[model samples]
Target: MDLTMSCSSLSLLFFISLHIHFLVPGSGKFLPFRECAPFVCGDKNISYPFRHNERPTHCGYPGYELGCDGHNPTLVMESLTYRVIHMNTNMQILEVARKDLSDDLCHGAHVNTTLNSSLFNYTSSDLNSILFYDCDSSPIFGSYPFSCPTSGDSYFAPVVDLEHLPQELCNFSVLVPISQSDEAPDRPPPSEDSDFGAPINHAARISEILNKGFEITWIANTAQCENCTESGGICGYDWKRQRFNCFCTDGAYSPTCNGTRVPGSFPSRNKKMGLKVGIGMAALGAGIVVTLILMRALIKQRSVHFDGEMKIEGLVSSRRYTYKDIKRMTNSFEEKLGQGGYGCVYKGKLGDSQLVAVKILKKLKGDAEEFFNEVASISRTSHVNVVSLLGFCFEGSKRALVYEFMPNGSLEKFIFNRSNTLEVDRQLSWDTLYQISLGIAHGLEYLHRGCNTRILHFDIKPHNILLDANYCPKISDFGLAKICSRQESIVSMLGARGTPGYIAPELFMRNIGGVSHKSDVYSYGMMVLEMVGRRKNIEVAVDRTSETYFPHWVHRRLELRQELGLHGITNEEDEAIAKKMIVIGLWCIQIDPRARPCMTQVVEMLKGSVDTLQFPPKPLLSSPSRSLAACPCESSSLQEGNDSSWGYSISIIRDRLSL
Candidate 1:
């Protein structure tokens, strides 16, 4: 009898232990529903779908976890952390503001606020407010101008005025969503006779709108949660199964807890006890595997967050296309317009029947930064003389830039006697060439001073300039461009950049001077000389000793007051235009950076007559001794020591020309 009683006690204890284990959450068994009592998080009552991190996972919906920082509640969505200012459970809306903007609006990372569309969405009452940073001038439209001691001037305006925001005057911009109600309370109604709309207190108005925060409604399993709650069960989530779970006092159910048994719930007490133990063991093993998979996914998410790919997407205003879309638009890389070291350009048409040139870049390792730089630099520009960026494609290693198509193709074929029908048929006249030169000068001037941020195009050559249907020159190919603040006259660079023959002396030889906009001026000078002479600056000869540098040849002729003996100069007017171009090109190519004229001065000189312009000093050195045949058109990594070969004297040519 004693032995039998001991055996019965052991059996009871084993059954009780199994029951308790099944009652616990995440055991893949029946989870008992306990009252998920509401708690205060930073003065706001949090409950149901939104729960603090200290609570169990089943207490809240997935991706809705909140953390407390001091006296405020913080939430992170789409990798951007925000402070929760208010929560309305009934309306299923949350009001939150960016933590970075709240702390330091001036120095925060220049990124737009992005939310997970699957989990939350902005309310209809919200309006986009843009902040233009490092603006050189105020907006033409009504705006609230503010200044940061370290960052310079900035402007804030609504999305309605975005078209008139003056992108040329701002170095960076960020889009922020604000409630229209917030603005309505602070702003006075516009008067009929008012020139500048309503007067606003800059600090108070902006602060109130930002601090009050914007509203976004949560949509994660809302209907299911409501159904579960109405069925007398606590709303929860089955993270392992990735579905809604309804918990009651006895066990967890799929949709509700109205006497429905979960998959692994305990069988009736009369069923076999051994079957229950086997099911429990299998569920435990499956739980471990699911947990491991989730952990790996979490690690991958963190890696992507730090990679900065999302940041790049958020910063650019242009449209983004996938690799498949690129192939479809290009018709499997058909109709190649041109090819270069960086990539190949293909003619493609958009859905709207708009012609575009898709430049597909080569898949080179560690060129991601260059691709990003090109996108960032060119997207900020808006000028008649600059190529328009329509869209872009960035997928893994496949990258491409989509630009408005130029019917005349690159200026290279036209300037150089390339064997193309378009080049022969559309031969550029002297007047047309002069207009192209003036247009290029205007584009450079806009890059240097017209924009809030100065852009230095290290590679400025005819090959990079595209001509439109009307023969208008538009500066293209910003692959080697450097963006700097307007205040930064000189910029720091890791190494020399630009085509070999057109690279400024300061780039390869640091002792000459710091690299600045004047470096671009040097490149422009070489290109103009090439256009004037209708040949390369340095031409390869059968013997290196007899090689002729075009700039040296042109300067010699100009010094002797000789007629520019060249093709296409049929009249005195043509000769005058040629003389004016040669003089301006010479002034731009001065060895000393300070001696080189700025783009603004170059534009003014181009507009003026040849008689008013004085002769610029002769260049100190001719072309380097290196053979032009071996150098590629795009050589960006020329070292400083290589300058030794470029010390050839021009005295021999000068004396010969004087005689």
Candidate 2:
């Protein structure tokens, strides 16, 4: 039977060779299999990169080689190379074939292998070494000394941790060759009876198949090791973990192990010394970051900073200004433009004809940084529709801002005054009103989206809008503005941010959603309708003051066509402008934040056809109990005629108490 088996094996080998040769005619090109030599033979179909002749000198990195297992074509790389798993322009990853256990007897064969460090190179600077295994099932497979820092144990189960394994064992799975068996001269035929168990095949039997020191070539620019340098690291084999160990030296830290600091005076020169330094550096950096965060929190807690002059390094410089200079400039508060929550505003001349308005900022229950930030943020932005910052003064317990004078005064003066009602004669033409609308949209657009960071004008109302000599609108009073990331929508309020009547419904109900740039769009829309109507919808109609707010009132009228004066206003031009403004306003104040058009779209509408305008569904009007709050509008500035005739003196608009 032995003689017959040997003869059969020789004949079978011949038959396979003949069949393979017909497909690949060259024999001289075959590479011999030595300890580390490349194997190349079989079909021409497998050539260069995957060759049948001698493996090309540069076919792959040193470890990978093309070979034929007698009659079976194979690609070998170290201990694995199960199959080509992936190949892209940059690199390739292969599945490692598993090694099968043939014998149940432990210690059946002494298989010992060691990697010669000089034979192959490792391509990944991030990766250290390869991990191997020693299984009790296969006695022929010997224990290989790996290069990791930690000793490893038997890991021959089906699912292996790939990340923990070295590059060579990456995707490979091992199985015993079926061709090798103990019966019939140890050469098994392909038939099921002779080919079946792993008992016939063993990794140790095919010594010719084993490779040593496979060199992994540099991936060129393919893999980026942004932080690694070759010098001062111990690049030696670590049998414990079966991977290369790179111990960094010389008071350094980081993945590249390149960051260096001065070493302490005691030079123990011990390898363990670097570990102590690494811990100290990490602790120090953490402490610094923590301290900064705590400092900011403390500042906010101490709200009295707003009452005194704050000397911050980067924010502002401390200085003094005589109150006399302010009195002279304002002519002792003679030309009072308006009065509000902040303080009274007076039109003054700084230099010859350099008209400026001075506003004394209100004292607030907050950190000085909040007040300063408001001034700094607005001062930096320069837009045609935004009020320009003129120099300011910060005296002890007193802070005042100076801005370029808007000669035509506030939008409320021209639009809603019961006495100085020239608005009918100085009617806002459709074109001029449209231009003003575009100007206001442009300013809000800048605040919402154009800056490096988004700013929300929490107090957007007609009084805060000032008209210049040209009737172009400029937004003012940024004291209540919120500075934040555009992505941040809702803000945790110490109190409500906007006025009662104009505030969006979402602002009051925190459960509804967060407030974003869209919230400001809603306020600006309410202001637009106020400007067009030139009437304070809430308090104007004596009886309705207890019923509807401006925005809701506008919606109700439009729904009934009483909005546009459907037949038309007695004054055609004013009526048309009113209709257009009302439509644009509806588009702005949509209750669903997403439904409202952005400021950019608002500007486009003002310039486009009013007929193209789309009106949003009417928001339910808030009842008087929920909407009206003591008519926040204060008593009007008393004129000379009223004072003389009524025997009443002009009660000065008291600072905080008036608004």
Candidate 3:
């Protein structure tokens, strides 16, 4: 009887445990633990939908977690992004905060950690997916020296406009020092000596500053310097190099930070898992193998699989042949035109005169829906600046798009590629660039005004803007694009979209009245600046001594009447053309989106005299998160997979251009 009672009790306990684990409310059991809600790990204070510990563990995933160190707060997951105070929730959009490292006081004591793809990953368990390395500091215009009279602490703060700051720093975290009583135990000591000697009375100062409500970057020690430089890794310190560690570069790894390995050799648990999975999958495979065997035996009784429903109109016409035909057209896919956002574009000829650019999309699964959407969206619009789609093919699982061949190829070749140095020097003159700029402007205007629904060309860099034989610019790659009607007004974006540098600020804000045609105008302005400077916006301008965004650098040079020199005055015509372009570019990139002229207005400004245009204030290097608001273009170092060669070349080009 005792033994039977024990067994019954054990059974009851087991059942109760299962019920508690699986049935209890808010117990984080079978609830959506695999996909974390956006609010689960963000700032819990400040208000609305932004939440902490509101989601089940399953919903939050491995990377998403609300971290607390007793006093202050932090949110960490795959990518290390910080939020100010989380207050708003109904919109479900969290604000991303960046620290301004240019504050010498903060720079002296703290370090900046670059949480790149190699170091960590961004798991979009939350509604928003952020690219974390996009933080930037203001350029050192002229440094002002300061010494805390009480502690003999001195450093330099790069002189950026404080009046226009709050507008410039909408979505960022400024670290203000606090008094000893308010400081958190987890906070790192300001000095490298392992102890912050005295408590700072920063609350009063912080309150005073906050009362002003100007967005400013406060320096602090949230970064992990010791962890970063522990091994033989290259240390990426703060702007002042006070603290930081060396993590391994590409094709390298080790906690000790020594040695390098081929990409294939990188340690992965997936290999072991794959072996285990193969054994378990063997049983299921046998049934499939037998089925396949039976199907093969009855091959003679089977019908052809090619002729199915062709739901997409232009996807596969009767004239559309098979993959075999595409093979023969390109002579077994022999020549490659170039690679692009969708996939590799191959040069092919249907007949004697009809040359076509065949775009073979990369290996993307379940993209049929997206491909069909793109075709539908692009098919409705027609303009000289927009790439024309001849037709597309979707036979079986393979998909390919055909377009009219631009014999001169993409603008990237002329603007970014060095191989066409001679051709560009002779043919891509200032007049040619101006024409290209106009064509691109017209294309943007058409999307904004001409179309029944305004289309947002999310990606507007030179690479996406192709140049034809006459040097006319054609906007390509409608992927990552959105369409909105004027009546609808606002289109809520999920997280951050578009390329790193060219994305707009309001897009980062939750339901912040997005979908303004002004976003595209801002991107165009950056592109125009690129065309004028003949360099990417992320790269530093040549004339500037330190690293700064090209547009901001131009603003400063213009302020000093030094802007013209940035374009190396070869003659009166070149100087005149460059000056006009710079001033127009500056006006197009005004910090206030409302202040920025519409694309139609931009076209007028470019065509109008430089003297008529009011010179824009110098571009401020605010927090990276705030860049979308003021600068729009993200700096070069902030981009992922940014090759050293790419960064070096841009730096060199800007230097040469500055001459």
Better of 1 and 3 by lDDT: 1
* Number of the top-ranking candidate, with lDDT as the measure: 1
What TM-score does prediction 3 earn?
0.49
- When sorted by TM-score, best at the front, the candidate numbers are 1, 3, 2
Error of 1 at 557 (Å): 0.8
Give the higher-TM-score candidate: 1 or 2.
1
lDDT tens per residue, model 1, 1-659: 46445444543444445454555443333443554545676688776687778877877788888888967789998677899988887788888998877777776669887777547877655556677788886654545666667876776664323323457888998777765454234233445212355333354445556777788888875677777778888777665456777776666676887746666444444445466566556555554544465457554655443443754666556899999989888889889999888779999989998989999988543535567777888888899999998999877667899999999998888877543233456578999999999999999999888887988889899999999999999999988788889888776542357777788876644334567888999999999988888877775433323237777677778878876787789998999999999988987887767666788778777888899876765665434323211211133221121222244343322221111
Those runs of model 2 whose alpha carbons end farther than 4 Å from true positions after fitting are 1-328, 331-334, 368-370, 418-427, 487-494, 540-553, 566-574, 621-659
User: How many clashes (backbone N, Cα, C below 3 Å) per candidate?
Assistant: 0, 29, 32
Tens digits of lDDT, candidate 2, 1-659: 46445444544443333222212112221111111122333322332123332533323333335455553444443343322222233342222222212222122222221222223222211111122344333211222222212322222211122222243432222322111111212322435221243333223323222211122322223121222224433222122122222224332122334543212212123334345345445544544544454357544544354324333324332222456777777888788777776667888887577898888666554444445655766755778988887756665455667788988887776666764245465666665766787899999988877877788887788788889999999998777777777666554331236775567655543222346676788888887877766666556335543234666666667767774432224576656667778877875665555556677777767777666665555544211122211110122211111001211111110110110
Segments of candidate 3 deviating more than 4 angstroms: 1-322, 365-370, 418-427, 509-515, 540-548, 566-573, 621-659
- Candidate 1 Cα misplacement greater than 4 A, ranges: 1-311, 365-367, 417-426, 541-547, 622-659
Best by TM-score: 1
lDDT at 78 for candidate 1?
A: 68
**What is the lDDT, from 0 to 100, of the residue 486 in candidate 1?**
86
